[model samples]
Target: MEIKESTLDRVKRLKEKYALIGQDIDSYLDGLIYANPLTYWDYIEVDSLLSLQKPKTDFPDEKIFIVYHQITELYFSLISHELEQICKNGKNISDAGQDLGWKDNLDVNFFIERLKRVNKYFEALTRSFDIMRFGMEKEQFTKFRMSLLSASGFQTASYRYIEIASTDLKNLVHESKREELWNADYHEQLDNIYWRRGAVVADTGEKTLTLRDFENKYLADFHRFADEYQPINIWKKYQELSAEDQKNPLLIQRLRELDINVNVNWPLVHYRTAVHYMGGAAGDEKGTGGTNWKKYLPPRFQRRIFYPELWSETEIEEWGKSWVEEVLAESLKTEEKLKDEL
Candidate 1:
C-alpha cells in the first residue's frame, strides 16, 4: 500500500522541518557563545568590519584604487583574526591548567595552512598593484599626484597594519615621514568610521622609503640575477618556504643564487606593462599618458640578471668572434668526418 500526501501538506511539513533545524542551529550558536563569552566580539566584529570606503575623486580610476585597497584591508583583517586565533590556540595547548585535547604539534600545521591562504591573498594584492599602475599612465598619475599633495597609500591604516605585522615578525621595517599640504574630510571620516566599527586606527610609522629607493632595490636585484640559469628556480624557493615543514639546503642555495626571489616578478610585470602599454623601444621617451615617462630598461633588470653572460660587453665581443670561427671549423670537420665514415 502506498500513501501520497497532498502538495500543500508536503509543503507544510517541509516548512515545519526547516523551522526545527533553524532553531537547533540557533541553539548550537548560543551554546558556543556561552562556552566562551569573551570571544563573542570576534563574531560580532567580523560582520561590522568591511563597510568603510568613501571615494572622493571623479577620476574613474580612483574608485578602482579605493576598492582594491578596501578589499586588501578586508583580507588583512581576516589574516589578523586568524593569527590571533592561532596564537591563542598555541598558548591554550601549552597552558598547564587546561588540557586542550588537540595535539600541540598540529597547531603549527594549522598556522601554516592559514598563512598559505594569506600568501594567496598577497599574490592577488600584488596583482592589484599592477592593475592600479596600469590604470595610471604618467600623465594620469601626475594629474592626481599634486592632488595627493600630502596623501599617499603609505598613510593608510591597512598598510600600517601590514607594517606592524611585519615588524612583529622581526623583518626590517622602513619608516618614512613626509609632510603633505592637502588633507580631506574623508580622512576625518576614516577616523570616525574606525570608531563606528569599534576598531582603532593602526599606528604606523612614517614613510621611510621613496619611489627612487623602491626602484633601486628592484633594479639592483634585477641586475644581480639578470643572467641566471632559470627564473623558475626562484619561484620554487618561494613555494618551499611557504610549506608547513619544508627544509632543504638546495632550495636555500637556489634562493641565494637568485637574489630577489618572488619579488622579481613585480619588476618583471612593470617592465612588461611598459613594453605593452607604452609601446616597444621607440615609445620609451613618449609618455603613455601626457606626462613624460622614461623608457623601460633596454633589456630590463630581470632579463639582465637571467642572462648576465650576454650583458658583459668584453666577453660578448670575444665570444662572438670565437663562436663564428668555431662554427666554421666544426662545419668543415663534419664534412670530413662524414666522408671518412662513408
Candidate 2:
C-alpha cells in the first residue's frame, strides 16, 4: 500500500517530537495498540457522576438538590478556569489548580471575550435557578433539608474562590468593615471577608459548624489565592490595560453585567428560593447550615459589587436597591401573615 504524503509528514513530525527527548515513537505506538478504546461514558465518567446523588432522605427532590448543586460547582470551576487563564494570559496551565504566573498578555478583546463567557455562565445559572425555585416540592425539600444538617450550599469552596479571584480583597470585606480594612493586608482582609459573616450565629456572634468546617478546609487556600490574585485579579488586570483600552464600551458593559450577575442576580435567585422554602423575610428559619441567608442572600444587604469603579456613585449606592424593594414588597405580605399567625 502506498503511504499518503500527510501520513508520512505526521510520522516524520512524530519521530522528531519523540527524538527531542531521546524516546521512541514506535514504543508509544505499541502502548496505544495495547490500550483500550476510550468510551464516551468512561471518558466523561457518567457512572461516577450519576453515583454522586446520594440523598440523605428518600425524597426525589433531594436528588435534584444534589445534582443541581454539583452542576453549579462545575460552572464555578469553569468561571475560575477562565479567570485563571486571563490572569496567566493563557500560559502553561496543565497543572490543575496550580497558579500560572501572569504573562502580561493584556489584550482588551481577550478580556471582553472571557468576561462575556463568565456573564453567560451566571445568566444560565440565574435562569436555571428556577429548578431550585419551583422544581422541588416544598414539603419534600423542607423535610429533606433536615437530613442535610450542616452541609449547606454556603459551604462550597469554588464560589468563594471565584469571589477572591474577581476583585480586590477590600471589596470582599463586609461592607461595615470595608472602610476599616481599606488598605489592610491579605490576612486582615480575609479575616473580615463578608461571606464569613454569612454563616455566623445570629445571636452569639460565633461561627457556625458549617463555616468552621469550610474554614478548616479552605481558609489556607483562600489566603493563598487572595495573595496570589490580589495584584492580578480581574479588576487589577482591567486597570493594567491601556487607558484607551480601558474605555472599550463592550468591556465596560460586560464588566458591569458581571458585577450584577455575580452579586445581584445570582444572590437574588437564591434569595427567592430561600424565601419560598425557609419561611423567609423577617422569619427565624436559618439555613440547614445555619447560614444567615436572609441577610446573606439578599444582594441589598450583602451589597457585593465586584467592579465598583465601573459604576457611578449613585449606581453604587443604590446597588441592588430595586430588586430588594421588589422582592421585599412581595415577600412581606406572605411572611407578615405567617408572623402574625406565629
Query: Which candidate number has the best TM-score?
Result: 2
- The residue ranges of model 1 lying beyond 4 angstroms of the native Cα positions read 1-52, 86-106, 136-139, 157-160, 163-342
Structure candidate 2, residue pairs in collision: none
Q: RMSD to native for every prediction?
A: 18.0, 9.3
Once superposed on the true structure, which residue ranges of model 2 sit more than 4 Å away at CA? 92-104, 280-282, 323-342
- Give the C-alpha lDDT of model 2: 0.82
lDDT minimum window of 10 residues, candidate 2: 323-332
Relative to the unseen true structure, what is the C-alpha lDDT of residue 270 in candidate 2, on a scale of 0 to 100?
Answer: 85
CA lDDT of each candidate? 0.39, 0.82
Give the per-residue Cα lDDT of candidate 1 at 220: 38
Stretch of 10 with least lDDT, candidate 1: 170-179
Over the stretch 1-342, how does candidate 1's per-residue lDDT look in tens digits? 555668657756655654754644455546767895466658767546545545565565656656766776777677555534443344444333444565443244554455445445555655766676576555554454445433433234443333223211111111111112113222222222211111112232222233233333343342232223112222222343435334332322222222221223333444455555555456643332222223222222212122222124653333322343343354456546656876
